[model samples]
Target: MSDRAAAFHALHRPGRPLLLPNAWDHASAAALAACGHSAIGTTSLGVAAASGKPDAAGATQDENRDLARRLRELPVLLTVDVEGGFSDDPAAVADYVAELAALGVVGVNLEDGRPDGSLAPTELAAAKIAAVKAAVPGLFVNARTDAWWLGVPEPRDEALRRARAYREAGADGLFVPGAPDDAVGLLAAQAGRPLNVLHRPGGPGLAELGRLGVARVSTGSLLFRAALGAALDVADAVRAGREADLPDVPAYGWVQELTERFRTDGHR
Candidate 1:
């Protein structure tokens, strides 16, 4: 395996889940990397919304690749979220994965959810996984099932079934966003791979998730949403003539230094 891919794989430790905080753009990614995260993921929703495009509607392929190329310049492991691989064609998806792999992306999050709020047939999803794995053997393909997120009947069972098929298809990880904390352990036990769960603010915390056998916990657009919420809250606070309750906001100089470092050392 490639050294970067190996590093990313090593981060997914069962019972000691890696906290993958997803970023939207270069500044967000650079800020997260500056805070010392070993690995960083791009949120597809963030990318789409930033560009005024709909995510998972096959509108962000260029955005995904562009972000991947930029994020790869950061001094950290990087993963790009390629929603449904941007095409139904397995070979096309594999080619996209190859492009990302060439840009030094260590991982990818490929979902089986269609923009129409339905699940792709299991066979097709599996084929995409297999193609990606064959094309970029070193890239960690986190196969995502939206059964639970899409409110599919018997979501748990469906997720598990798809997980099994994806595992056999060479998925390196399994992601079930919106999976209930209660069912998380069951999925983790049966998936036969590292289970990645989206972190809900009031749901099981990281420590609890680790005990449940989750190997990866992704912020999954939460940070981007939180940032937006924070901005709105501050705007409202200012309108109401109340001080914005901001905490842990980094200094302007620090962010400037990060941008400068990127400009100077990003080439390395």
Candidate 2:
């Protein structure tokens, strides 16, 4: 198997679905890697915000590529969120995917929802998937469907239709961030490809997710938002002369240890 394909499988540990954390920058991705994560993902929201662009709007294509180029040197495997493939033009989308693969990224998440909160045509998305695969045959495409986000009947039938189309178009797997747990089996069975679901708060944990046949679990923007919120809370608490409620926070020496580890490996 290819290195990129192996990376994706390395993420899925049988009973344990890949608890993929989405990082915004090198430090965040490195911090997670230091904590023993085998792979990392980039959040579209974080990427867009970092580049001063709107998320899911075909914005920040260059920024995303730049981030991937930087993260390619890191120890962990990287997957990128290319919001709607960064353009409506299939050729442009394929070019973007090709760049990402060249940067050593193994996987990508391409959504089907437009910036206007409407769903793109299934055929359009299928074409995007095909174009990307043609541009980079070994790239793992996690075709994302946002039917639930667009406020429809959740479009199980439509979702299945799109899922099949993407699979035929060479998508390696499928991601439905807002997929309901009750219908998880149905989705997985129909997908033919592995079903990837977002890790929802107070929802099914990793074990429960595996039982539902979820092959991958993505912590979309939750980690980034939580980390940002924690930093702000601690700063605000200090201003109020109060102690922060941060979890067993890493110490200065422990953080230096990460740099040391990388430095020893010549990544310094």
* Model 2 vs. true fold: TM: 0.92
Could you tell me which residue pairs clash in candidate 1? Answer: none
| Model 1: residues with Cα > 4 Å off, grouped in runs | 264-268
Report the lDDT tens digits of candidate 1 across residue range 75-135.
Answer: 9999989999989999999999899899989999999999899999999999999999999
Error of 2 at 80 (Å): 0.5
Candidate 2 per-residue C-alpha lDDT over 1-268 given as tens digits, one digit per residue, 9 for 90 to 100: 4776576756654345778899998777879988888888999998888778888887788898888876776788888999898788999999988888888888899889998998898899999999998888777888999987777664788788889888998888889878777878788778888888999999999888898778888899898888888989999999999888888788898878766665534555
